[model samples]
Target: MSINLEGFVRRKTKLKLGGKEWIFNELSLADFARLRAKMAKERKVNLAERRKQLIEEAKGIGDIDPLKLLEHLDKPVTDEEMDAEMESIEGVGYMAYLSLKYAYPEVTEEDALKMLSIDKIEVVVGAMMGGLSGDKKKPKAKAKPV
Candidate 1:
């Protein structure tokens, strides 16, 4: 058998947000799937009807499972739409919740939502994406033999 060492373990890092330190875990496949599922559910997009439309347009496209194609159909999303989704309760809010809960197991999703306000969300999410919160201070040189 073969084993790929890459991403063998979940990455954990400390991120400062809202003037507090938080441990952020790399989003595992399961976590990503959960995030996407929640967003899809809360966004209330009519995927089923859209899927039906696609299947109709794809009539006689050979021996394929038309019903299965429904799984892949979704409205062509716009950047604006995506940005809106990211700010919604089920969007980045949910992601922040998920990321936070991994660190403080007791934190409820409600608590996570309360933690991020409109003003702080951008900073927290930006840090979560990779920034370290503050700039590094340069070290001073030491005296030779004082």
Candidate 2:
């Protein structure tokens, strides 16, 4: 017998951003991975572009300790760094696009742009990252019939 899981679900929210209300749904694991992949791709491109320059700049340094140079390379990024990166314009836009795409699969690129703006991107990012919780309406206490 299969058990029902209908009661377990993330909240869908309706909030104003860019002077308009857009309903947003929680990002699925795949959706979140896509955003992370976008950022990782950018980081890879930057490192590739700077590889030659970095090597040339480091030339003539007698003793090279590769371990010391890349010791923290494998370390995971800190939460603060991730937060700061998401706050950037590119990150904010991509995040907003992903959020919208997840919420509305039929959303167009033009509409996605319209959904996010400079003044409200932070709020949108915050909501997506769980920095703000007031977006969800609170339920009132049930009263007993007298």
lDDT of model 2 at position 40: 65
Error of 1 at 124 (Å): 1.2
lDDT tens readout by residue for model 1, 1-146: 97787766555656555688777665555665676666566445677677667687668676667767765554444556656776676576777777777678998778778777776665566545544442234589988996
Q: Residue 103 lDDT in model 1? A: 72
Weakest 10 consecutive residues, lDDT, candidate 1? 127-136
- Pick out the ten consecutive residues of candidate 2 with the lowest summed lDDT: 66-75
Candidate 2, 1-146: lDDT as tens digits: 98896777655567786567786666666666676676666666676546555555456574764445444343455567667876677666666677777567888656766667676665665566554643545689999999
TM-score of candidate 1 on Cα atoms, chains taken together = 0.49
Top model by TM-score, which number? 2
Q: Which residue pairs in candidate 1 collide?
A: none
